[model samples]
Target: MIVISDLRIAILGLGYVGLPLGLALSRHFRVFGYDSNPIRLRELRQNVDSTSETSSYTLEHSKITFLEDIKDAQDCNVFIVTVPTPIDSNNIPDLSALCAACRDIGSVLSSGDIVVFESTVYPGVTENICGPELESSSGLQCGSGFFLGYSPERINPGDRSHTVETVCKVVAGQTKGVTELLERIYGTALSAGVHVAPNIRTAEAAKVIENAQRDVNIAFINEVAMIFKNMDIDTGDVLAAARTKWNFLDFEPGLVGGHCIGVDPYYLAFGAQQAGHEPDVILAGRRINDAVASFVVDQIANMLRPSSRILVLGLTFKENVSDLRNSKVAELVTLLTQKGFQVSIHDPRAARLQAKAFYGIDLAEDLDESYSFDAVIGAVGHKEYRALDSSKLLRMVKNDGVIADLKGIWRAYDFPPPIRYWRL
Candidate 1:
């Protein structure tokens, strides 16, 4: 029996999803953020987040304690897991990080404590996989001695409008009483209120499908882009014309690569496959998205001759964030290099050292240097890249240079008359 007033919240895995939630929860409850990475803990204490999702001011002002050891989180009654649920080499759901977080929480878990999982996973992950781990490790009976809950995180890395507090939250628990307790806890921070799900599996299914839906939508647009390329029609222009229809979904075509959209579908698909149902649309979407890197490479190669100098606009998975996990830009760079093109990657927010360590590619921070290229590939629609003048960017290329706009960031009418442009 725990009182709401005495709730001490511990958030595990303080990355993009956990950091913001920890900051928000710390305002009302005694919050402790735990991560296995000591470097991350040190960086957070100094008000520096490599992810760039949260500002230094917010981290500095938030009354939250940081811990690198699992033992430090023992006193917390409400544990929230927000670790990354990434995919393996074969595009399978690799639950190693999530399982490690659960195992750590289980070791320190006490009776009457409530564990809430915010990591995006397939249905039955929290109750079926994590709950048993907790019970086995802590020697406690679930629902009787300890309780479990699932509240899928809706944290978009670059999104400003739909933040942690503003977005509607879905919460579920082992039992009805546990559900009410989670609702009260989350309702304190979420201004958009909370939706109490029937069960933990339903909550997990809802979150996984959210990203899967986005993946399918983007895959549809990417396929359209490929079709438009064959027809010599601008995909963006067609989308603009189609937008006049009231019921049309305005989904743009681009490389779908990130921690969530690219990976979450696998988690759902894996579970679906285990249940003996082959997911056609979901697997098809994943296949289309996976092949987009090579498709982009082919389009770029066709636009330029061999041994041409190409500049890749951004390297991070998305714009304005430093997260490069499972980025598709690397594949584009590799394919372009293999085709005898000299590629130079530049991103304002991405960490140069991390990029070099992870991808073996050095990132150039300054684009002001006088270096002209045969083409400028707008791979990512970062705000910094979008704000640049078309004329200035055109000057970086030769008279007959090509501009490959993957995200359609530049207007076709705005490009110089002599320059050739290709957009998806």
Candidate 2:
């Protein structure tokens, strides 16, 4: 086994997960961050992170080098894979990115080297799926010529509290020595420490269940939201009263769109189906959450006046981040437009061209200067929008206009009594 102190490290696929991990690891080891996107490499070299996870100062202070070529990672003894594991159109786990990364890293795999995967996957994906790819591409024997590990990423984009170093890391390896080495290497930079699992499969299962549990919880809230809407009761008020009890988990209802929560459950459900076991609650939760986009649009149509001019605020999946992967906001806008309402979107952080290309919706550049609309929907709780004065937003709407607060960014008591307000 190679000592943790002597091993050179390379991180492949530098995005939100990989870039932050590479920056943190580079503080202690000789690190190289590789990506196939030349444009991304150039941006990182200039100390500009368009993802907004790592600032210019943080990237510059870290001793990490950005590389566009795979050869730059050849000499490293420890390689970490943090590429995205997105699902295909059929919602099946797409291993193409993982397979391609393995083939590239396997070409240069040497004895005593370890490759760790931080992408979320079903149990046994690292060993049963990725390990064989590494062996086949490198013409090496697993557990002898090369080894694998799993350390699932807990990165929450736009979250300042639970970062890479602060969050407790779960690390696992094929062998005991490999597990210990990874723990030691991660311990040097992670102040929150690490929990070493018994095996790679356990680590992968733990990661999948983490998001699945949240998906189920949010689905319950979404169902309640639909129920309360029909009953003419405020879901937020019900939650507020329920929270007076001792042990109530305060999960709010909104569009459950993002890479992790919306996509991770499918991976688990797929594995369960493959093993001849059916997942009822998991798939049911996904079904309810998936229909929420159209549900929101239906609510808006029922409330708005004829030929209403609507403004949708915050286009990103979450607040204060430009990442739009699997965003439900786009679906809501499409549904609203189909109902004959003219809709316009405004997101301070989302790129206009990117939104136009992905969703075919032109994002308004200036919110303050734009024309007033009959309805305003706060889709995402971005800080920039949160800082806006409620009076100004209320004024943007016509008399007796609706304010659909998906994230509940405004106070119900603060709004004028005449205006109709709805929150999820």
Question: What TM-scores do the predictions have?
Answer: 0.97, 0.98
Q: How far is candidate 1 from the true structure (C-alpha RMSD, Å)?
A: 1.3
CA shift of 285, model 2, Å: 0.8
Model 1 vs. true fold: TM? 0.97
- Model 2, 93-156: lDDT tens digits are 9989999999999988888789999999999899998999999988988899999999999978
* lDDT of candidate 1 over 1-424, digit per residue (tens): 6788889999999988999899988888899999889999999999998887788998888899998788988889999999889888898888898888888988999989999999998998888888888888888888887999999999787788888989999999988888998898889987889999999999999999999999999999989889988999988879999999999998998888888999999999999998899999999999999999999898779888889999999998987778888789988899999999999999987888989987999997688773589999988889998998877888878888988888888874467657888877
Q: Which ten residues in a row are the worst by lDDT in model 2? A: 411-420
TM-score of 2: 0.98
Listed per model in order, the count of residue pairs whose N, CA or C atoms clash below 3 Å is 0, 0
Q: What are the Cα lDDT values of the candidates? A: 0.89, 0.90
Clashing pairs in 2: none
Shift in Å, residue 116, candidate 2: 0.6
For candidate 1, the per-residue lDDT at 219 reads 96
What lDDT does candidate 1 reach at residue 243?
A: 96
